[model samples]
Target: MSISMKLSRTLGTAFTGLLLAAAISTTAQASGDSVKLEKQDWSFNGIFGTYDRGALKRGYQIYSEVCVSCHSLNYVAYRNLMDIGFEEDNVKEIAAEFEVEDGPNDEGEMYLRPARPSDRFVAPYANEKASRAANNGAFPPDLSLMVKARKGGPDYLYGLLTRYQEEAPDGMELADGMSYNEVFPGHQIAMAQPLDDDAVEYEDGTPATLVQHAKDVTTFLAWAASPEMEQRKRLGIKVMLFLFVWTGMLIALKKKIWAKLH
Candidate 1:
């Protein structure tokens, strides 16, 4: 046999072995305790994708009205709401609704004042200890980076919010105060189901269903995690375009130089 023919056969056998190993690994994972996460078709999904303004507004409403009691968005400020199409005046009004601790007058005493656009979102508890105490020793994590922190990002979050079961499967025992959630690791979670149908009325007349709330909130948190995503994608596109043009020019120059040598 020719050397080239032998090399091709060897390469083909190695590729076949690699494929078989990958298939076995995937089957093992599928048979394990890992839960299959549901993927969502997010508006901000591709290089040209941008956040849905309507969803952002509705998500902010859901977070403020429903999730705010336990989770806090410490990284997001009221002024940032303008990115989601909120007017400056509306943002100010939203900020004013919450009081933040700020002070030290001539008397040197701290006092509570209405929050400003520059201030971060307020925590539900005074501190970590207080937060844990309030929730039966389970601390609620800040939602500011939750989407980025989790394994499946927005998909995992949306699943966690909407996949809660009223009761565990037969023969499964849930610890006291724990909730059953198929998407949550261990099929149990410290936090109970946060959203219900009609949990909050949407100002834009969108359906106030549990699934809708989950999607909107996931989008909002995804935005909060990476507010500059659109800008970054734009820069990437420009860079790619420049590289393509530069490569074509280089190729043409190389051909022109070789023709002179010939």
Candidate 2:
């Protein structure tokens, strides 16, 4: 091809790519957030607070396959997962997926025990291996409550994960040994997109796209932040009811007490 023709072709390809990406982002944005959680701050109140279980389960699968390798959720317990709607039998079965060293038979000797519902989810690497791997020796953040901690919480969490380009943007500085993240705590984060299109199979009907994974995982993190989401709504209703009744009674009492004076 002539030099001028080649240049034109390359520029056309670049423009086409940009337009396609914008179209996709626009469509995903239009799905209309199902949960009422704010998109700009990391609080967890929302319409359902509970979303697609399939999404949560897919997120758990992704975490196990990708994220758990370098993070920890020491605050979580297997039993606490009853809140996730896991039955007792399944919880124990899931917990037993790991082995723990427990004091043997009250004799003060240690033995390997199957993890229980009360046991914390295990970190993938013992310690040093995890540190050497990512985030410049900083442990990859335990994502259990990540959505809650991040501003824009769920929406930002989802957007950041799925929004990677095949290469870093021009003029961006990524250290020789580090990676690029456009929207991380420092913006010069050590982690890259741990997830992207077709990285894993989606058991849920959610399309096997990067954004879907982000949405699913964000939903899972939201659940971890407040497993009592349903309860919070129920209690909110009860409290509002009690306040209404009490206020009415007080108004009636004031009227009765002041009848003669009035």
Best by lDDT: 1
Q: Write the per-residue lDDT of candidate 2 for residues 68-181, one digit (tens) a residue.
A: 767777677888777766689988998998888777667878888899898898766566555666456656767678767876777767766755445567887667555555
Worst 10 residues of 1 by lDDT: 97-106
The models' CA-based lDDT, in order, is 0.92, 0.71
**Per-residue alpha-carbon lDDT of candidate 1 for residues 60-148, written as tens digits (9 for 90 to 100):** 99999989999978898889998889999998999999899887867999999999888998888888899999999899999999989
Lowest summed lDDT across 10 adjacent residues in model 2 is found at 34-43
Error of 1 at 13 (Å): 5.3
| Candidate 2: C-alpha lDDT | 0.71
Q: Return the clash pairs for model 1, or none.
A: none
Q: Best candidate per TM-score, number?
A: 1
Q: Model 1 reaches what TM-score against the true structure?
A: 0.92
